[model samples]
Target chain A: MAAESHPGYGMRSHRSTLLRRLLRYVLLVATALVVAFPIYITVVNALLTPQQIAARPPTLFPLHPHWGAFASAFSTGHLGIFLRNSLIVTVTITLAELVTSALAGYAFAFVRFPFRRTVFFLCIATLMIPMEVTLVPNRETIVALGWFNSFPALIVPFLASGFGTFLFRQAFLGMPGDLRDAAALDGYGHWRFMTRVVLPMNRPVIGAFAVFAFLSAWNQYLWPLVVTETNGVRTVQIGLRQLQALSIDQTNIIFAGTVLAALPIFVILVVFQKQLVRGLTAGALKG
Target chain B: MSDTRRRRRLGEAALGYVFVLPALAVFGVFVFYPLVKTFVLGFYRTPPFPNLPSHFVGLSQYGSVLTSPAFLDSLWRTVLFVLFTVPLGIALGVALALLAHQRLAGIRIFRTIFSSTVATSVAVASVIFYTLLNPEVGLLSYWLGGRGGAGILQSPTLALPAVSVVTIWQNLGFVFILMSAALQSIPDDLMDAARVDGSSMWYRFWHVTLPLLSPTVFFAVVVGTIGSFQAFGQIDLLTQGGPNNHTDVLIYSLYQQAFVFNNTGVAAVMSVLLFAILLLLTAVQFRFFERRVFYGR
Candidate 1:
């Protein structure tokens, strides 16, 4: 009698536990839906024509989806030029940042030099200095060099990234001394060893920082807006804002342009979400 | 003593310095040079290019800025923004971090959703939000107000706070990610130990978590405060410094006085004042670090 009753109770308890998990799954799925709603709305609205968007209750489908916005964005304006300008600025900054950061990180991590720790600390200290405090002076220096309104004006000032130096330094510091010793035993020398061995191992991290550096440089508005005024060097962001200012009357086009401006960033985020998350938490936690 | 070995040692040392000097040179030209230029430019005024000769105005520009009502008003507004953003950001950060730290189902998905906005540029965010909050065509108002109601951005009283909401949302992901990592560094053993002692979760968090998390909290506060002061792009894009210059901070004002109004000296003066404020605040923060930071010791 005891065995039969116990077996029946155990099965009943397991069934309720299964039911609880099912309920939790439903709730989790619901939460995810709400969280994803904004991106859904943004993309849907971007694809839809103005008339379709204006319709009540906002049906999920557009009456007539327009691929023509992209064409208009390109042909009717300097969006092409803006894209070229963005590419040039982003590429140059990334190259400079990578080269400088690797060397500096290598030095701080591996090399024996006078006041090496102090120099590294100072480099890290630069991270704490507010960007605003430096903006005026940075601008003055750029103008004084006659680089204002030029591409160099946008690029040169930010070549020394405190955050990058810090990242590289810490990553390099974690390297085993025996690797360098082994390299030295082979007479590879310091620079060659760093170039061959250290840099290759650092590719994962460098790729991560590359995305960050590119995004940060590309998204720059305050400094770029201040420096570049002419159509010759205008970036996509600056151009979009200028276009929006023109579209106060035509609200649809303004939203359309905003959607266009936000597209590349949104796409990058979606694809590289994992890498960016890893990079951010890694930098924050490690540093 | 082998001369070749000694030479090789020297060469290696030389190589290290050689590799590093170019980066140092760039830093010197770009950052250090401008740092010095700030002091010089503080005392002079010049017209924009195709012209030369900054008239040395000495202390007059500085004097005028120090006494200006507008400068004082901006300083107050900046303080208000800092006061609003820092604590609120820290609170939101802590809440979101702790919420994700729970053993709830699908927590990773929740984290990714909250953090998605961090990848969006401030420029993109500002643009997206401006459209969303516009007086006429904005969806928020269309939903909230049946028809013909004032949009948040179009209202002078509402614009700054509305813009602040966008900033807060944008910055939330960054702060959450940072603080969550900080929280993770605190081993679960500590919480379990407190639970064994009959402490509630709130009690454990208040006693254990916060003290341990103070360093990151302090860091976030400083970064948030500094960013608040320097904020220009959102205000410039959305409000154009205001429905009536209601949202102008120091950087926006500096941008206007220098470039828009062509009062380069006055702008330089305002910039210097901004620098001084930041330097003083940083100094104070550094001084507090030794006393306040728990470091789990």
Candidate 2:
């Protein structure tokens, strides 16, 4: 706007505009490089020999690419076991969270209730408490129930996320109330209305949430680390951390393992980033 | 106000609780119950699993944690880590949102690129970063500092900040996304009017944009501060609070005591401390957000 003003202002504005444009280009490229280089480095190192990796001023691009590290990491470190455990944990958690939170969100948004606000607020209150507060108590309960080192310990506790419930509830609230009334008048019961009328409309939000819940379960480290001491139950994060300990000098294998671990999540984000951003703002930023 | 309508409302209320039932039950069992048990454990001398040695020794774990050098070091480092990341994160988030708000072409690619990290787990990310930041292997160290040998993660003095930078970088996307949405919702008329009144861009941002977007910023800050306080994965993977426990955060200390050394009681005390801090911050967030937030719509 200023660039279209008076001569002096216009000249100054033009200079600044060019400067800002240059700055933006510089920053975008730089930030992207920063975001991508770690992945790139891991990929490169995964294909390089250990001695090549240890070389001072290591090769910017791997001179001769090899896949020995990847092969070894997969076979030796029980990465296969970790991947299976991760897939089972993440998939089960995602499905459970989606169903539980969706039903809960629907009831909160549409169903008539006396203490509705109180219940919703209490759920919201849970969001404020840092996960740290509950860490020890949860372990104690796990120990008490003899649920330690079990999948149920991982699955049951996080079945319905407060964040996911809020997202679905907000989406459900945005829908017209008349849709439900129309369904009811057509002889649809509550469950039928929810399934036939409400749920189909809420797919995008649910898709978004499924992505989020999966990410949460996938990225979740402390809970998995704390709860599952056995190798059979550990998540990829634990698997990767173990690699850190195992690889002291030759980091090529660790890098390969890291890349393998991050690949699935990276692909998902590249595809679903828009929905993820929208879903995040809708639930977290909005009142 | 009719009887039938009142009954319907009552039914709805019951349904609300029912809908939220699974959440409350899980949260109670997994979150609250565990939290209380941890607090109680903090006060007691831990017995052998089936009860060979146990007692209700109040405040002793707290005393021991306070006296122990490791706990103090961890607490201090966590505070420092918190100090650098929270304000810096908010600032970066706000700035990115501002940048993204420009009516420039091809900006969505930048947005997507930044947001890409959100899907990444700490394990994967840490592993990726640990290699990229390896003093010998990393590309960044050279441009950042000459010789670039013994980079930030390796130095005890620099380890926390290095970890903080990665966290800030990783989290910047979500904050930017949230704040950009908030900024976008602000009407163009307001900006035009301010410009007609000859307000500078800085004035427009400070006087107009910030007030309208404070709620989003506040939300970001609260989440950021709480997150920074509870950060564990980065330190564990990258630094291990090593080179003399320079970067050991509170959560890592808790993990060490609880799992590594089996000082469950001391770990429990520190968890309560972290919980208390979180509770205080949450209360403060509600107060600030309530008073300062502007609902433009």
Candidate 3:
């Protein structure tokens, strides 16, 4: 009788646990739906025509889907050109930051120099000077250098990053000291050691900073909006703004442009999810 | 042998400087020079004509710009924006993190959904919200009674709050990621022990979870404060500091003064003031909140 009663109690607890799990799943799915609602709506509207978009109570789904808006966004809206410019600018900035940061980080970690502490301090101090404080003067410099409406205007100011330098420095400092000693014993100098040993060993950190640099450069708006005057150098962010301003009435076209602009970032986020998360959390968690 | 070693050491040190020069040059030309220029420009007033040279006003411009009604109003608006976005963002982030922190199957997909907004640029986010809040045909506008006549973005009183909603939504993913990472760092043993103590879920959350999550929460507060203070994209894209300048935060006002009105001196003053405010806020947060944050080591 005791054993039978114990089994009944166990079954009841199991049932309750299962019910609780079901409830948790329901909450998760519901929240996910809510969070993704805007993106979903944007995509749906992107696929619909203006008439369908203006229908009363709104169209939640694309009953008559079409890709004409995307084609128009690329051709007439010049999103294709903007996207190309953004790619060149983002890639250049990312690669430049990685190279500069890696070199600087390596120096700070392993080499000895005069005013080493002072120079390192100066590099990191740029982090405190918010970009807004420097915007007016940077724009002035850009105009003075004849870089207005040019790739240099968009890319030059962002080629080096204090955050990236700090990240790489931390990563290098965390490496085992004997590895460097071992490399040195083999007659490997700083460049060789960095290229062959340090760079190969710190792939994760390098990848993390790359993801970070790419994201920031791609997302830049204020500077690009201020500097670029034509489609030749305008980035996708600025292109989206122009599209919206020019075609405010055409909701589908604007939505299509937005999707086009955000598509690459989405792909990057999914493909480099681990590194991106690591890079983002690096700032909050480490400090 | 010792002399050669000393010479080699000097050579290595010089090489180190070579490695660091490129980065330093970039920072010096772009960051440091511009910072000093902003300060200098703040002291000089630009004439009405483009070709006319700026005159040195020497601290008077600072005095006037800092005390002007426009500056004060914009400052207030910026403060309001910060207040509206930061705490609420952090709260929502924590809630989302807690919800997705479960060990259930296929939870990774939900976590991805929760953190998805981090992928949206400020421009993309502003556009999304702009469409959703459009007066004539916006779904959100229709549902929320903002349709037909001057939707939320066009309403003077509702405009700032509407912009804030977008800011909060855009930043939600970042805060969520931070809190989620912090949550994962917390050990299971601590939570299991709390459960074993027969404490209610609420008690465990308050006493066990929240305290451990304080540092990241504090980090998010600092980051969110700085980000919110400098918010310009959404303002530029959505309202253009419109509805009678209701949403004209400091950054937008500064942009207008510098670019639109060509008031470099005034804009530079605003920039310096912004820098000072951020510095003070950061220092204060570090001093005050650093003590309260539990390391949990």
Candidate 4:
């Protein structure tokens, strides 16, 4: 009697568990769809005509797709130039940030110096003093240097990042001390050890910071807007704005510009999703 | 110590300084010096006229500007934006994290979808929403029951909230990623123990999951508050702080004063005041929330 009851109970619970799992998936799929709705609409509308877009109750999908918006965005919208500029600025800034951050972070983590703690604290303190606070004076400095509407103004102020320094420092400090000792015993100097051993071991952190720096540098709007007066050096973000203003009636063209501006980052996100997540959450989780 | 040993130690210290110099130089020019100059600029009033010299006004402008109705209104609008974005972003993030945290098949795809907005820059996000909020052609406007004629972004009463929605949506992926990470760090045994004790899922979530997640929540709130305080791109792209200055938060106000109106001294003062308010808010959050955060052993 006990054995027979046990089998019946197991089957009932199994059916209920299956039902619960199905319900969970249903809810998850629904939420994911809602969250991703905007991107889907943007992509679909980028392929639609202005007439279709303006249709009452708006076209939900591109039944008949048009690719002219993209071609026009590149040809007339100057999106190609903007994209090249964005790529140049972002890559340069990311590389510079990595070099500066790795060096400073290594010094703080592994080297001993006078007022080391105080200096490290000061570096971290700069994180609190955001760009918004320093905007006016920085702009003056840019103008004073005759770097207005130039790459130097966009690139120079951001070459050093306190956040990057802190991230690298934390990652370096977490490394095993024996690696350093081993490298030293093998007649490795600071530069050699860092190049061959330390940096290679911390690729994950480096990759993480690289993605962050690239994203931020690419996405910059205010500083670029303030500094760059011409389209010669303007980034894609600003270009998208210009496109919108110039073609107020052309919704499809604006969407195409947006798609172009956002595509690179989305690709980056897809490729380096792990590093982005790990790096972003590193601060929060550890704190 | 031997002389060689002393020399080596000194050499190491010098190298340390060398490694740090480039970073410090950049910071000095861009960050530290500008900070001091901003404070100094606060004391001198630049006239709206381009050719006119800036007059030294001491603390008079600070007094007047701080008490001005324009400044007060902008501050209030900023606070309203913070209230609108941070908590709701956090709640939605938690909800998404909870849904995605389940041990279901193909969960990774769902996680990616949920966190994809993190890739969208403020500009991209604004542009996406710009098209979505268009009065005549916008599907969202139609579905959302936006009143006939003007879109949500154009409506004086609805503009700020509309902007806030974009801000929240843009930040959703970040909060989702953070919360999902926090949820993953939680031990499976804790949930199993509660289940064995016949505690319902809600009870376990309330008693166990929430306490463990408080630290991340606190971090998100502080960071979200700071981000909201400095919001600019969306306003510039969408409203330009118009339709009666309803969406003119403090940062936008500072931008107008410094760049548009050429009230450099007033803008400088606004920057200083913003920094103080942010510092105070951070300190207050730490004092109030830090003790309540549970660090599970």
In candidate 1, stretches whose alpha carbon ends up further than 4 angstroms from where it belongs are A1-39, A54-64, A113-122, A128-131, A134-148, A246-252, B1-6, B45-54, B103-105, B146-149, B196-198
Off by over 4 Å in 3: A1-12, B1-3, B146-150
Residue pairs in clash, model 1:
none
Model 3: pairs clashing at backbone N, Cα or C within 3 Å: none
Tell me the tens digit of each residue's lDDT in model 2 across A132-165. Answer: 7777777767888898988887778888788888
Q: Give DockQ for candidates 1 onward, in order.
A: 0.30, 0.46, 0.45, 0.48
Compose the digit string of candidate 3's lDDT tens values, residues B143-237. Answer: 78644434789888899988998999888887888888888877766777787787888998899999999988988999899999999999999
Which order, best to worst by DockQ?
4, 2, 3, 1
Candidate 4 regions exceeding 4 Å error are A1-12, B146-150
* Model 1 C-alpha lDDT per residue in residues B1-297, reported as the tens digit of each score: 699988766776776677567677776665566556666777886656637777887888788789889999888877877777778878978877765665555677777776666765677668777765655555556665755444677676777787787777778877887777787777666666776787776887789888878877877877788888778888887777776777887888888887688776777677678878887887887688748877664
Docking category for candidate 4?
acceptable
Clashes of each: 0, 9, 0, 0
lDDT of 2 by residue, B1-119 (tens): 99998887777667667767888887777766776687788898766563567778998768877788877778788878888888888787787767656655687777676666665
Residue A177 of model 2, lDDT score = 68
Candidate 4: residue pairs that collide? none
Q: Candidate 3, DockQ to 2 decimals?
A: 0.45
TM-score of 2: 0.86
Error in Å for residue A223 of model 2: 1.0
What is candidate 3's fraction of native contacts?
0.66
- Write down the lDDT of every candidate, Cα atoms only: 0.72, 0.76, 0.89, 0.89
